[model samples]
Target: MAPIQFQVGEKYFTANTKTLTEGSAWFKSLFSGSDKLVLKEDGTIFIDRDGDLFAIVLRYLRSQKVPVFYNKIYGHNHLLYDQLLTEARFYQISYLVYYLENRFYAGYVASVKVEILGLDHGVDVPLPDRDDDTDVQYYPQWCRKEVYVCPRRVAVHRGNPGGCGRECRAAQGDRPLEYEDEWVLKTTEIRTQTILKHNMDSVKP
Candidate 1:
């Protein structure tokens, strides 16, 4: 059988009608009848959509697998996944849309709390010269004011919950210089409390 030729934007693509129809309901409906299609003079169907994204969509139709967005050299390209989601929605590919949404966008809200605890001494106070206290000095006691507490909201992706702690620490900023001293007895605690906002599985296609 002759392959179906498509012109998406400035690019051209060809695929077997069986693959397109099986992968997408939109394509199945589009080619439902023998006389339904209105091909251009060049014998190719024209689709007013992104050509580059259509290539990815076509690849998925052939392979029936999600495209790899991450590599050792460039890491994960989240923007590419987002673009694929858009293209999948446009093509009415339910499985691709479901996979993309659950793998990346589906996540819970987390409340991150970072606390710094230790004793911190303030500047020494000098006592006034008196008959019996001329050489005396006064030092204020360590107080709770020295403790640091930072609260933040981090979106925890279902694929990488461990990354939430790293994001929380970064958002809390650097620790105090005094805490860096070996002699200073300080403790840093990072806590993450997860809150489920909604279930992505229950979302309708």
Candidate 2:
């Protein structure tokens, strides 16, 4: 049977489904001469220097396609991922939110101190438990869209936030720090209480 053909438009340029043939021309137009996407073995795609993969992801998101990719290469970290996901939710990208929720539920990434050791460690935190208490001391705070590490510790080993960006080394010289114990994920109960308090405070007599 012949396939259905739909008129190409700017919207098609951002389509992310596997069945992306009808709008090939329009999709090609969105890309600059130097812009290109490379598929990785992990099922993620990388864009050229001039092309922002986030835009592609957003396009797919608009088309209801799930976009899953971590952009914390050099110094970016899970905090950035969380922040991005938050923005994704704010913009009403259910697909991206679903993807982020899965990552959070499946524990594809680690919290902060507890590295992605395995599925067991990932399950330890649990999705609902994330909002309990954020252990900022060790895990670094994910507030205000930036990962701020303490300037008193050092990244003696890999993934350690020592001297890569912040000055959290000299602040804690040679002190065997216990960042792991500070895993403070927020709890649902606390969140509910805070919300209720805010509502009451905003109420007029």
Best by TM-score: 1
Query: For each predicted model, how many residue pairs clash, with residues at least 3 apart or on different chains?
Result: 0, 17
Model 1 agreement with the true structure over 75-163: per-residue lDDT tens digits: 45789889888988878898888878886433332222233333234333333334311122233342232322332443343223344
Q: What C-alpha lDDT values do all the predictions have? A: 0.60, 0.37
Poorly placed runs, candidate 1 (over 4 Å): 33-38, 104-205
Point out where model 2 deviates above 4 Å: 1-56, 62-65, 70-77, 102-205
Residue lDDT tens for model 2, 121-165: 223444443442222122322212223344443445323554344
As for model 1, its CA RMSD to the true structure in angstroms is 22.4
